[model samples]
Target chain A: MMRIEDILMTLRMFQDENCDVRTVTLGINLMDCADSDLATTCRKLQEKIRRLAGDLVQEGTLVAEEYGIPIVNFRLAITPVAWWAADYGVDGLVRVARALDQVAQEVGVDFVGGFSARVEKGATRADNALIAAIPEALASTERVCGSVNVASTRAGINMDALLAVSRSILDLARRTADTDGFGCAKLVVFANMPDDNPFMAGAVHGGGEPECVINVGVSGPGVVKRAVERLRAGSPDLNLGDLAEEIKCTAYRVTRIGELIGTALAQRLRVPFGIVDLSLAPTPRIGDSVGEILQMMGIGRVGAAGSTAALALLTDAVKKGGAFASSSVGGLSGAFIPVSEDAVLAEAAARGDLPVDKLEAMTSICSVGLDMVCIPGDTSAETLAGVMADECAIGVMNHKTTACRLIPVPGKGPGERAVFGGLFGEAPVQPVRSGGEDFIRFGGRIPAPIHGLRN
Target chain B: MSDNSQDFIIAVMAKDRPGIIAAITQTVFELGGNVTELSQTVMGGYFTLILRATLPAERKESVIKQHLEEDWPDLALAACVRRYSPERLFEPELDTAAYFLTIQGEDRPGLIALITRYLAERQINIEDLYTRTEGDAITLILQIHPQNRQSAEHLRADLQNFGERQGIAIHLLHRDILRATSEVGAIRRMVRQGGCLS
Candidate 1:
């Protein structure tokens, strides 16, 4: 029998700390839904999605209630439209995006991803069309998300494709200027992207995945933050090693719940359970931010001297614990430091303590690169590509998945706020300096790094 | 070590003291018995123990009771012994079927009777229970098992309403969750078992 203290402590982690399965994303491969005619393709896509994911939300709710944990969102990741519906140009892709949005609403999902293009080495005709359609597709649809993979360790950075994608990203921001460039929040640019990520705006059913699967994303930044706070309150001499162990134990428990819920949900849906991603995805709520976890680690102000090391500790401990908790762990299983989504991180940016430069430095050590960052609208396309290029270089060299969701809030400058309501929260526009315009305009591939050819 | 062995149930209660369990087991050992399953607790000023032991088939339940009373007369604790059989099931499948029903509120009376009656009417069994009071606060924790496939949601809703009426907080959760968070091996064991039913 479990002790009464242990039972109440676990309940406290839920009722107080923001521990939840952030998303239970059902990945459905839509390669078979291809058709030459646009309407046929749209109908086939919608029908297939409805057939597979119609019961996802209801079953997810049942599982959440049974487990006594919050499964906050139900999302879908379909095979990239660029691969299947790419022969259809920008207009056709936008229409496909609309159909995806409608079906997402009908099936009661929060988001549907994989309106994406992968032009790592070079762009095919399909990749180009999807890249062109990204701005309008995201702007026109509510729940549809897009991602463009412009670099990889094996194939190096595709500068040409990245330049085109940056322009589209800028266009996307302008198209939703009414919401302070919110449309760009639904798109991501990645280098060496994971095929099985269950979070948006980068989630997709990659080519390597099964036909249909259930991937669960669990988050508990607040849980870890509280654990650290408890340790600090108990002993003043508590060392980093002790802190790491505390985080590892907390993360292990959270991952166990994620895997349990994932297994139960997969059984209920009758699909193979894909993986449990134990990333500490924070929300706008207080105590739920990875930034606050750093604060609990003795960093008084975020973006101070040791923020990167703190983040590295957090991200590594999370992965170590999650690895033992689930045998089928994949996706981006590290701490997310999204500025706008995390309240403390956003406030730090707003106060100029966490600058774009410090954020980029943290990107090298955190889960994903430069997530949910708002930049000045006057920042040039070349500068946008430059930022992507720098982050991609880090990922290519380190063999980690790095992505950027940089929204240039139109007509907003540094120290001004851009609000994207709900989970895509608000952040002050960060200043972007112009140092790499000449290099970005050169527009040629940076060949794969030497270590990338280890195999 | 002998094949011809019989199991005996032992119960003892006394004023709370140190070494109560050690003395009872010592008495059982001298009687040529081996302790198998035992539970002991000290609440308020009273100590209580219930144990099951195996002894040679020759030793009867009355003989074991007489030995315990004779050996530890000064202890002044009640002792009872009985022959054990496997004909009756005393507990539900505890490993999987256990849940915790917790009630917490200002100090009051009749909380257990009120909640237990509700559970009894629904055919749900309360296998074990514990209560603690500190100042004006009181807490009752009951380990319950629902034999049939009952909708936990409905039970929760009903409990919430009852809690509201009584000005207390009542909650129910699976025991596996507590075990999973507290024990490192619990989760891996669950994955190996596979196909977990709610």
Candidate 2:
């Protein structure tokens, strides 16, 4: 029997602190939906996604109600479409994107991922076609999300693919200039992307995954923050190591809740249960910012001198706790610092306390890199490519997952705000240093680092 | 005491002291009793215990009570003994799911009666409840098991309405969430057993 004190503590965490499962994504492999004809493939793809994911939202609601924990989003991730649409042209890929968007709406999923291609080593002709069509496909669709992997530890960095994606992101921003370049928010560029991540716009049903599986993403920055505050108040002489211990214990509890709910939902759906991503993903809601956790750790501001070290400690402690709580921990199981999505981070960005360089530096120790960051409109494609290259280098050298979801709000400059609303939140455009055109134009693969030759 | 071969259920109460358990169990052992199960707790300066044992079938309940009173007269021990039947050994399967409902408000008359009446009308069984009053504030923590699969949304709305009418705050949550957050070993056992039903 559990002690009454334990029960009351958990209740306080839920009622006062913001602790809840972030997302439950169903990854459905759609490689078999391919066909020689474009129309047949589109029809078959929609039918298959609708058939597989029809009950996903309803089932998620049932489980959330049963557990009394709010599941914020129900999403779907499919096998990379570029692989299936290899023979098809750019027009054919757009049609497929439209079909996916339609099916996502029909099934009531918030986002459909895997409109992507993996070109870390080299780009196939089909991958090139999909990259060409990204701007239009994203602007036309409401729920389809796209991601491209351009680097990895084994393959080094594909600078050509990186340059192309940078240009595509520019075009995407230009196309959605009305919504402050919101189209770019739906696309992510990655290095060593996880195939089973349940969060978007980067989640995908990798070729290695089963036909269908349920992956859960758990979040609770507020719970950690509260625990830290309580510890500080209770023991005025507590040190950083003691604070980290409290975070680890709190993360252990949060991850276990995710595992329990994910397993129960999977059992009910009769699909194999996949990983539980223990990332401390924050929402725009007040009191749920990962940056606030850094502040609580005594960093006065998020981008102060000791911010990176603080984030490293936090990320490592979270992983340690989550790894112990669940054997099936995978995906980006660390702290996420998406600027616009976290209220405190966004405020710091606006206040000039957190700059793009400091954020990039923090990425080396965190989960996702440069996530939900907004830059000035006139920032050139070369500069964008340079930013992506720098982030990807960290991932390759460290052999960890890193991604960029940069939005260049067209015609907007630094000190201006771009509001994307909802979970995408809003952010003030941060200034970027220029003069990287020559290096970005020198487009070729950055060969694998010395660490990549371990095998 | 009943026949030496019979099983007996016994309850013992006395002023809480370190040697109470030793003396009580010694008395039972001397009566040719084999202890099966035992539970003891100290509350408000008094120790209480319940135990099940098998003893000589010829031993009568009155004889065991008399022996406990005579042996622990200084401590003023009270004991109850009765024959145990097979039906007394049966325990119900814990198939029903559990939930935790907490209510907080200013202390008032009939608060517990009013809320319990609502649950009783809905066929929700209260497994355990604890209430505490500090100054003018009262907090009630209740563990419940619904007789059937009830829609949680409906229950929440009903509770919300009740809270509004009574001017109190109510929170209800599944017991598994609490267990997962508070007890790592319990969650491990639950996962290893392939379900959160327990």
Q: Please write out the lDDT profile of model 2 over residues B1-198, one tens digit for every residue.
A: 544388889999998988888888899899988888998877779999999988898889999989887887787899998998777332223454678888989999999999999887777778778787889999888987666555344676588888999999888878777767776664545644634332
Each model's iRMS: 2.5, 3.2
Worst 10 residues of 2 chain B by lDDT: B88-97
lDDT of 1 at A406: 95
lDDT of 1 at A386: 95
**All candidates' lDDT scores?**
0.88, 0.89
lDDT of 1 at A378: 76
Tens-digit per-residue lDDT, A151-244, candidate 2: 9998999999999999999999999999999999999999998999999999999978999999999999999999898899899898889988
Candidate 2 residue A201 Cα shift, in angstroms, is: 1.1
RMSD to native for every prediction? Answer: 2.5, 2.6
Question: Which segments of model 2 are wrong by more than 4 Å?
Answer: B1-4, B85-95, B151-157, B185-198
Q: State which docking tier applies to candidate 1.
A: acceptable
